[model samples]
Target: MITGEIKSQIDRIWDVIWSGGMSNPLEVVEQLTYLLFIKRLDDQQTTALERATLLDEPLVDNPFRLGKDELGRDYDDLRWSRLKNMHPEEAFDVVANRVFPYIREMRGDESTYAQHMKDARLTIPSASLLSRVIDLLDAVPMDNLDTKGDVYEYLLSEISSAGKNGQFRTPRHIIQLMVEMLAPEPGDTIVDPASGTCGFLVAATEYMRAHHADAINSGKWREHFHRQMFHGFDFDNTMLRIGSMNMLLHGVEQPDVRYRDSLAESNTGDADAYSMVLANPPFAGSLDYENTAKDLQRIVKTKKTELLFVALFLRLLKPGGRAAVIVPDGVLFGSSKAHKELRRTLVEDHKLDAVVKLPSGVFKPYAGVSTAILFFTKTNSGGTEKVWFYEVTADGMSLDDKRTPLLSDEKLGALAVLTDEEHGKNNLPDVLKRWQSRNSTEKDRERTDQSFCAPKADIAAQDYDLSLNRYKEIVHEEIEHRSPTEILDELDQLEKEIADGMAELRAMLLGGAE
Candidate 1:
């Protein structure tokens, strides 16, 4: 099903170019969305017509009532038949103005209210582009379940294109890793405050499917799916709309994706609204400090994205609800008023589950900031029992010239070390060995000397700076057992090569001047 959908999507894209239209992939996708909605509405109307005919009744519930009239003011001048053969620009204009307006009216009906189609959200492209897109998308049967996912997936990918907005969308692979580490349960409500394209929610759903397939299939999952399993929020209306479709494409219809900035402190009422929250929030972004200061002061008391989101996540979760979030590395060690309060709250007030340091290039092609994964649980006891930290400098991937993900290697390494059960005083030698090697004594986990673990006692000594590097030791590579003469020879050759290069550059410059 996924394969066919992908093929159809490719075909649609090809047709747009063949029909004499120029558009980037992202622009083309925006146009595809407008058409897909119309086609789906048409399909719904057709189904209604069939059912009404069989039951000997009128199609009273057909909200769009697409075929009932010749045309409405909404469709510019293009109708289905007219659009198919017209010039690309003419067709596009008709669809953008005429068709979109009608679809907007139909979709906005209170009865059909949904996060994805909450009226028209697309920044409709030019008529020529819209025409080509419509022609392209029309090539596929938009109502086909398989094709729909493919088209939506394509759009989701396009949304991640450079300069669109925000960081490039979080990759699905990384999202899956976060969900697996957090291990959301059956009845647990999963939320992503900065959901962007809903990558985390989709991953959480997949996690549920794999771990609780039997429970999900018995229709028991409906309760969880509708009310518990997923919640997402974002400030960008476009992102919210895109996120809605992303969830729907993955079978999460009627998703609870609210359109609001989760990092803003003014929205505290909406915080503390979920159980499990996973997010890759908008990075390097700041909120209104003066306005949010009152609410924020209660948490970190400083207006920073990392601190605000931490407070937001804590407020959102029910007591004992877990969260795994990604934040800039500076948040882990930066000396700021908010940073201090953020650490105090996590290590002292909440249980710090684990801190996994990530390489700087994970967000390459968009954001180059080094990052860390903070896995924490809101505890009933109001104090941390134990905390684990992994200072992963190299996940088997070079953080140099080329930024490639070594998922298989890094994931396997992390899985081997991260135990699901408590690591405190376990008779488990393998887990103990891994932990001990990665960290010194448990006290080292909290100490201010190493890059990884230190106990509560050590943490208290540092006034509870929860920076992983404060405790985890940076182990230097072992020096090779080579003679001093051999090392000197190597350095001498390197120096000679540098001198030769300089001499050549000097000669070239002198010749050019002459």
Candidate 2:
């Protein structure tokens, strides 16, 4: 967790940047990404230097050397460590003129973060503001993985709360809930096609580090975790930079985060490549069929971005590879042939694991559209026996524009430790627990409960409509009905009282007139 003081510092920097004429939140984050990445690189090199000296070994590489560049500034001055100690004007000059340009060349031709950084430009307006930000950022420690990653994550959350760029961020708690449900293994190769900010991929790295620490600690798995495990695609250049920085801060050395228009890009070379996919693609929108990928169209012909993304997932996943993705509610029960065919494919050809309904307010302040998480495995032959269903009412936060937390921080998210009473405020913890037991106890649960299973045959009977209400049995409150005789008697009494009151009123009026 990032401390309150750290959050304040970040917010202050953001306000400074916002007032500095960098109005776009995404642009602010991108600018911040450049500086943070530079700082992180210097910090890593410093750690390596200390370790090597302590072990009496030669330095592997020196990112900076004492030499003058063509611009006549010492190469060392471009580093965060050196720039932090310089005068404000000097620091600003170095950052704007040299440091920003130098970062693109830090990593070789093949580095994703570097590839994204090729377009880096310093948008911080003034010397004093940049200095103030550096001073404030310097105060916050970024030594440990958690603190460093949390710092960036907090900044992203602020961007979300700031409104314009909230569309780029998924609520971290919701991301955590989805990650906990998937429980990514160390060996899993995960991808998020519409990878804005790469929240799912970052959460998966955290999950692997937490649950499969032993396997990941091994050199082979560590290499895989760093290089091959996490992949993300996005067409927006700003998002690619932000997502790369996000993964890098989270300790993923080299994630496959690059530019790709997921829906439009052909997947012929990468078909059936990934073992896991997790995403929350754009919702309730359509794309032009002319630009849509032919292969995705072959899966299920649709222009809806939501349905096309699902088809993209199906195309990308290797046989038996699993996925957990968010789709709008329309995809759940839409009567269109494309929607029905995709649902049928999941039920008839592949294994549809579960459908978890998220609250409409989950994406609020940006979108209030209802959405649900679809968990399924790609199998050529049908294997879906019964699909688990969960109705998530409260996600520990209010279902409103503000999305205020209803409970303390500890009582939130899927891994939250909450009492039974607290569970009502946050269903994610219960959702995770029930999901773990989905094959066993979850199947036998009654339809009226919050979560249960629907047999494959039953789903087929409903034309593959996967809406929760289609299978969910509402336990309406029982009310006692009045007998017909009693009702008529009450009506007669009312009529007699009306007549008596009217007669009394008429007599009083007549006496007054007389």
Candidate 3:
């Protein structure tokens, strides 16, 4: 967790940028990301030097070179530590003229971060503003991996309130829950088709490191972790840049974070390749059939982005590959042919593991679309016996725009020790617990429970409708009412009591008068 002091420091930097004429929040974050990237490069070079000294070996690869570039400017001046100490105007000139060009020309091993720096421009407007921002950034503690990740996440969360292109940052806790449920292994190939800042991929990496540390330390697993384990696709260059930086900061050395429209015909490669996928794809939009991928259309003939993404997932996953993806509630029981067909394909053809219905406000202050997480495995043949359905009412947060945390730190993650009452307020912990035992204990739970298993045959009978409400039996409380004669008797008794009281009052008044 980032301390309050760190968040305040970040906010101060943001204020300086805002007052410096970069009013767009996304632009502000992008510019800040560039500076941070430069700082991180210096830090990496310093660490390399330290390691070389300790081992008494020559440094094979230093991110910085101590020489002049073709423009005859000293490359050493572009280093963050050197630039930070220079006068504001000289520092700005070096960053604008030298550093930006140097980063743009960086190739091969540095291509992941360099690729996005091609169009990098310094728009801070004034030398003093740039200097102030750089100095504040210098004060932030990025030595600890957790602190750096948390600080970047805090910066990303700012974009959520801005609301650009239906993109909202998935709550960190929600991402953690999905990653925990998936339980990605060391060598598992994971992909997020709509990778926004690559939160899903980062969370998966963290989970693996936390649980399978020994496996990650092995040579084979280490090779996979550094290069081949994670893949993400996004069409927006800004998102690509941010996502790639996010991976690098989280210790993923060479994640495939690149630009590709996942739903377009151009995305033909990587079909049936990955072992796991975790995503919260955009929905409620339409696309032209001519532009939609032909392969996805063959699976589900529709232009609705929501349905297309489902088809895209099916096309992307290798046989026996598992996925946990978020979809709008309409995909669950829509009457359209494409909707019904996709749901049927999952239940009849693949292993539809579970459908976790989320609260509508989960995406709030941006959208209130009711959504559900679909857990399934690609079998290319029938494997679904019983589908687990869980209705998540609260996810350790209030179901409102504020989204206040409802649980204490002790009951936060997968290993959360929550009592029944706590589980009632936030059902995520229970959802995971029940999902792990879906085939055993969950199979016998009644339809009236919060989570229960609905047999495949029952689902087929309903035309493969996967909505929890379709099979969930509501246990209406039985009400007892008095009969008409009993009601009349009660009325008569009340009338008699009223008459007796009236007579006693009259008698008392008459006796007093006599």
Question: For candidate 1, lDDT tens digit of each residue in 234-328?
Answer: 76665566666556555554578777766554666755557788998766656666666356668777656767878778888888788889988
Candidate 1 stretches greater than 4 Å from native: 1-29, 33-116, 121-165, 393-453, 474-514
Tens-place lDDT per residue, model 2, 212-323, is: 8878777569889989999999887877887887787777878999989888746456889999999988775577888898988888898888899899999999998999
Supply the TM-score for candidate 3.
Answer: 0.86
| Clash count (model 2, backbone only) | 0
Assess the local accuracy of residue 229 in candidate 3 as a C-alpha lDDT between 0 and 100.
92
- Model 2 ranges with Cα > 4 A deviation: 1-15, 39-85, 136-167, 265-267, 494-514
Candidate 3, residues 1-514, lDDT tens digits: the string is 3335677888899888887788876677778878887888788778878999999999844677767867687766878899899999999998998787776666454666567667888878899999999999998877634343454455555665424355766767778788889899887999999997888998998898899888776656988997889999988787788788777767776788888889988778889999998999886678998888999998899988889988888888999999999998999999999999999999889999999999998887567889999999999998999999999988777778666667875575556888888887777778888888887999999999999999999999999999899999998899999999999999999999999999999999999999
TM-score list, all predictions: 0.65, 0.86, 0.86
Looking at model 2, which ten-residue stretch has the lowest summed lDDT?
Answer: 160-169
Ranking by TM-score: 2, 3, 1
Worst 10 residues of 3 by lDDT: 144-153
- Pairs of residues clashing in candidate 3: none
